[model samples]
Target: MSAAHVPVLLAEVVDALQPRAGETIVDGTFGAGGYSRALLAAGSSIIAFDRDPGAAQFAQGLPADRFRLLERRFSELDAVTGPGAVDGVVLDIGVSSMQLDQAERGFSFMRDGPLDMRMAADGPTAADLVNAAEPAEIARILYVYGEERESRRIARAIARRREEQPFTRTLELAEFIEKTLGGRRGAKVHPATRSFQAIRIAVNEELAELEAGLVAAESALKVGGRLCVVTFHSLEDRIVKTFLAVRAGKTPGGSRHAPPVETTAAPSFQLSFNGARTASAAELAANPRARSAKLRAAVRADAPVWRAAA
Candidate 1:
């Protein structure tokens, strides 16, 4: 299969979801239709979503009666499917392989293209932020989202350089950052990787979208419904981990002096399995992208969905 068609942890996600005949599933991040296609083959109707306008092309061959694609953010899932409706929701987080492979989409520094990293077509491009944002804000985005320690120095350099000429292309900023960081020093990953990831996340508002989508999934799933999330980076995985832990009532520690926290909010979900599942060694050999991928799943409990504090 082509890289674009290879969904990470496909079999594992399907097994976790256990899509039965006549059931409905929400493929929240319908990147290349990999999970949606597999679920349909398993006899479940699919409600798939993708923010990218280009994603519709992949839905052409799917049976209209069994599958429907929504050109909207997955965070609005509950709005489309009422509370306690769908049987399953599966989300594959981060930029799709299809987007990275296309140069004009500008999701990858390895490719020469416009520095437009918005997941949807409507938002501010990466170039806009790189060229216009204050240096401190840029530094914070790199530090918090990318976990890059050299964020301040890089941001300062970017501010200095953009004064001469604005960054418009992906490789232009990448090579500049690489030089500012004093070359790779033989690191296995490219020097610009973290900065690129940070910019992409900021441009797309990905982490916030993820948190909202998870809450939407909770509101949309019926009792015993399955929710599976495949996260590609530590930030995404951390959010999923914390969300599940809190919802499952597995949060660590409550003070003896304080009231027991269990009474505050009932458990909304039960863990499908302990910890997170990583790609098997055999599967790892076939797809390098799966190296950082982790899958976490849970079954919806018969309790009300937890609402956020005012």
Candidate 2:
């Protein structure tokens, strides 16, 4: 198995996949290849995907034939595998430990590093957004992605500060944000948490990627194949929850806020397990990061893939 960081909910994710020998499985986020390694050990062949070019180093030593790592984003899974060709698909959403632990990656506010949060090596960095985006747009991103109620206040501070000196390093922005919030109080979380999350999400466009990847996974899995997703934050969990709920034809009937819901097609998937599952206390103790992790799994129905709703 490759040396990707230890996967969160390893046993539970594998159990949901129920991979067997000779089956081909998709590990949509191959950060450190923990899930791919577990799937490999389960007697399944794996086609792993990761957008970060740096992640390719972890693919070394994995079996050449049984394991293949694509430097492509998980959103491209359908293009790689073709329709209904794989046995199962699994996605571990959001940033990985390898990225977070590296100060150079700028994924965490706890440590200082470059303000480059691009999961892939290229494109606009977090520095680019904070240094260039309009204050209102920045405020909107923080409000929508990070759920920060004080987004405008924070954005105004950022806009003012960047005028004197543009943010170039991760800690520079983090400390500035904390100070703008009047310093940390008794709260266990850092004051910069929400802004960092918001900036990172904008830099990477992660939410859109997640939505596209979910649709791609649906297109790639075979009949009776499984789809498993693990998400850390509420935004990601909401997407997974709603996608599964909608695909399973379990969306609640319409209310006054909306028109009557339409069920124009057969269900695309059946729940492999009941609702979302959380980590056990034992697992949480072993890895504090597992505290917020949520797992959702489903099996593909024989019905044809439905067009993405508008």
TM agreement with the true structure for every prediction: 0.95, 0.95
lDDT by residue for model 1 over 220-301, one digit each (tens)? Answer: 9999999999999988998888788878988845343222345468899999998999999988999888999999999999
The regions of model 2 sitting more than 4 angstroms off are 1-4, 253-261, 308-310
lDDT of 2 by residue, 85-199 (tens): 9999999998888899999999888888989999998899999999999999999999999999889999999999989999999888888888888898887888889888888
Please list all clashing residue pairs in model 1, or write none if there are none: none
Q: Cα miss at 299, model 2 (Å)?
A: 0.2
Candidate closest to the true structure, highest lDDT: 1
TM-score of 1: 0.95
8: Cα error in model 1, Å: 0.6
